[model samples]
Target: MVRPVTPASAGFRARGALVAVAALVLLAGCSADGEADAGASASPSSSVSAAPSSRPDPDAPLDANQACAAMYVDGGKTLEERIGTALVGASDGLDGTSADQMHAMAMELGRLEPRVPEEFQGPLEKIRVPFLQLQEALDLADGGQVELDIASTVAGLKEYEKLC
Candidate 1:
């Protein structure tokens, strides 16, 4: 017998979708050993060497390629890895620690926004926006919003894939 979807049922479906998406993103970011793939730097035009430190120089100007390299390669922990970690954590449960991690990653992206080339800003913002929204939804215990936030985050990650 076909059953009309109720609000409660819809919430459960959304939560399930969010969990599936989070798992996919996390798996995409890791390898068999569960470590981030070192060679998974985003740029395709040329090979960029890892920087001495994880962070780019705040004082120095960066081109789009250099900025992309700094974001994914220079850092021992790539931004992609961080995003995967945060999303998986949030999907596991809306705990205080997971919310804090999401906020931290969003802030990290915010700090890097100005340092990157002008072309990269929009894509970066796309990813950052959902991170913040998801954190807020978690704090508020909004299940529907949490699902929407996660979908937005996945979409944002797709946008970022084109940038690098």
Candidate 2:
């Protein structure tokens, strides 16, 4: 015996199909490594290669002009802007956005600390210390420590800016 499909049953089957498709789409984006694969049209650096190295000597000290250029090439300005914005926002209130920014900036600096020019790494590290403390203060709502750490971070940044 053959049973005719009713409109209601057809609609329910269509909805179930749509849900399965959506689930597959979402699962396709998930990765065990927690990193998404960039599209094929992404920037060149996103791909790995075995090209010869042309980077300058990491131990060599750069002149002010070179130092500034290197900083920009290494995304220093972007880091500073993000960290500064986080500091300012955290100063107003210790909210999730501010805290996330601070944590992200701190982790970024930790990764970049070793990559900076040898001469600037020390001062760069000094600035990172206060960033850590600022994150902690924000988490704890310790306004007094936050103010002091902010001052210290500003001072460290000024020193680093001189190298730039």
Candidate 3:
């Protein structure tokens, strides 16, 4: 006879499912041709460009307006758009690929932090923290922490949105 599921058993099953999904996401990132999908980085609201003008000044400090301009450079995905794209992969739940995307984005923002106005640094850190935690959870394979990380990410995003 089939037995009714207990809370502990249900939690175990959920964790197992999360692991399976993470594995699938990792595998799907690779193709038979050995090239990642180009569209993977494209956001609905922005396009990727390799032009020199599309790049931000790596060494120069920027005022708030300049920092916002750098952050929203045309032909490159805006921060909001990038986050949205990453979240699309996390619609059902957080997976390795999504976590990696967010972590990379956070790293990119960190690189820009030194060049940004002091007023913007705190909000940028707020955005980066949850993304970092999300990746950490994935790295540790802590399925239970993924939900909390995702929630934190969304909250952080909301706070950062008030800035630019």
The collision pairs in model 3 are none
Q: Worst 10-residue stretch by lDDT in candidate 3? A: 1-10
Q: Rank order by TM-score, top first?
A: 1, 3, 2
lDDT score of residue 80 within candidate 2: 52
By TM-score, is 1 or 2 better? 1
- Tens digits of lDDT, candidate 1, 98-140: 6788789888888878887887777677667657666565567
- Model 3 lDDT at residue 7: 17
The predictions' CA RMSDs to the true structure, in order, are 7.5, 20.4, 12.2
What residue pairs clash in candidate 1, if any at all? none
| TM-score of every candidate relative to the true structure | 0.60, 0.49, 0.53
Pitting candidate 1 against candidate 2, the one with the higher lDDT is 1
**Which one wins on lDDT?**
1
Q: What does the lDDT come to for candidate 2?
A: 0.48
- Candidate 1: lDDT over CA atoms? 0.57
